[model samples]
Target: MNEHLKVLCSLTPCFYIKREDQASIIGGVIEFIKELQQFVQSLESKKQRKSLSPSPGPSPRAPFQLSTPQTENPKELGARCNSPFADVEAKLSGSNVILTTISRRIPAQIVKIINVLEKLSFEILHLNITSMEDTVLYSFVIKIGLECQLSVEELALEAQQSFCSDAVYVNDI
Candidate 1:
C-alpha cells in the first residue's frame, strides 16, 4: 500500500481503501488526501440529512457551526493540545508566523496539515509535535516568503480544511 494510504488507514480504522482505488491526481498523495477529505464530508452531509429529518428537498436549517473547545482560562505553556477533530490557529508577527493545530492522530492527517503550511511558502524554522493516545499537537514557527499573500485568518482556514475530519463525531457512517 502507498505510504499516505497506510497513514489514512491508521487514522480511519473504519474505512478501508482498496489498492485499486488509488487513482491518479496531479499532486499525487496530497491531492488524493484532499479528495478523500471531500468525499468523507460529502458522505457525512448526506448521512446528516437522512438522520436529521426525512422530508427534505433541502433542510432550512443552517449548517453546523464549530468552535474551539478550549476554555477562556489560561493554560500553562506546555499544556496538551486537546480537540476532538482539529483546532487550527495562525498568528502572524511581522514576516514570521506561529501556526498551531490539534488534530486526531489519524493516518495522513498530519501530512495534509503540514502541506498546508508548505503550500503557503513558509520556512519551518521550528516544529514541535506531541502525540497523546488519540490526539496530536503541532506547533510551528515559520517565516513567510515574500510572495505569501494569505492573512492569518486565511492560514487558519487552510489548516483547518487540511486536517479536520468531519466524520469523527459520528459513530459509524
Candidate 2:
C-alpha cells in the first residue's frame, strides 16, 4: 500500500485513481478538463474584444464653459478666472501617496512633474493624465521609499513651490 501511494503521488496526470475506483475518477477528471478549456476560450475571446476596442481620444463635443453669475462679486470673478490653475491634493496610504493636480494644460508639465518625483527618489507606481480643452488633470500614485526623509507636508510644499506655484490650494487626504 505504501509503494502504491508513492506511485500515485509521482503520477503527473491530472487525476489519480485507486485501482478499485478508476472509472469514477476518470470521469470527474474529464469533466474538469472540459470546464477549464471552456474558461480559457472565454478568456481568449475577451482579450480579442479588448484589443479591437477603440483607444481613448479627446472628445469631439464642444469645449466646456462655466456659467457666469449675473451678480457682480469681484471674489467670484477672480475665482472663476483662476479656475484653470486650481490645486494639488495628496493622499498618503502606507508608503504610497496618491497625488492629484488640476491646472492649465502647459506643455511638458507632466514630464516636469515626473522628473521632480524621480529627483526626490520616489518611485512612480502609476500615472494618468487627462485633458479637456485648456485644463489638464494629473493623478499619480508614488511609492516613498524607506530612505525618503521628507514628510508628506514637506513634499507637497516643495512640489508646489518648485513646479506648481500656480496651484492655489494644496492638501493631503
Candidate 3:
C-alpha cells in the first residue's frame, strides 16, 4: 500500500515537477497555491450566499457600484506623475475579494496601492491601469483569501486611510 501510494503521488504532475526542478518549482507552486486559493474562495462565497437569504437588495448589475466615498476631499501635492486615467473598484468573486482603484495624480495611485496591499498580505490577480477620460484610472482584480476577510467596509476604510494622502484622491466608483 505504501509503495502504491508513493507511485501514485509521483505520477501527479506537480509532484513530478517538484522532484525534477526543486529550485525553479516556485512558479508552479505559486500557481498551485493560486488555484487552491480560488477553489476555497468559491466554496466560501457559495456557503455565505446560501446561509443568508438574498436581501431584497438590488440584483447584481453591470459595473455594480459596490461602495463609494461619503465625502470627496481632494488634497493637492506638487509635481506628481499622473497617468491620465484613475478609477478604483473592488468585488467579491467566489472567495476572492478583488479591490481596484485608479488615479491620474503622478507616481500612479495604483502603484502606491500595490505597496499597501503587499503590506496587508493581499494577492493581486490582475491589474490594468491606463489613461481614460483625461484621468488616470486604476483597476485591480484581486484575490482575497481566508486570511483577509476583506469586507466592503474594511476595504473602503483601507482605501480612505492609505490612499487619502495628498498623492492620491480616492474617488467614487
What would the TM-scores of all predictions be? Answer: 0.48, 0.45, 0.41
Order of models, best lDDT first = 1, 2, 3
Rate residue 74 of model 1 by lDDT. 40
Q: Across residues 72-153, which tens digit of lDDT does each residue of candidate 2 receive?
A: 3243221111122334545564457756566556677787788778888889987766565655667677898767887555
lDDT of the candidates, in the order given? 0.55, 0.52, 0.45
Residues 10-91 of candidate 1: C-alpha lDDT, one tens digit per residue: 5532212323255532224543354345335544654575588656333322232333323232431112222224556565
Candidate 3 lDDT, 45-150, residue by residue in tens = 4446446746532122213123443322233111111111322344454445545444334555566687777766678776655453433445455666557755
Top lDDT prediction, candidate number: 1
> How high is the lDDT of residue 84 in model 2?
20
> Once model 3 is optimally superposed onto the true structure by TM-score, how far is the C-alpha of residue 44 displaced, in angstroms?
37
Candidate 2 Cα deviation (angstroms), residue 126:
0.3
lDDT of 2 at 59: 25
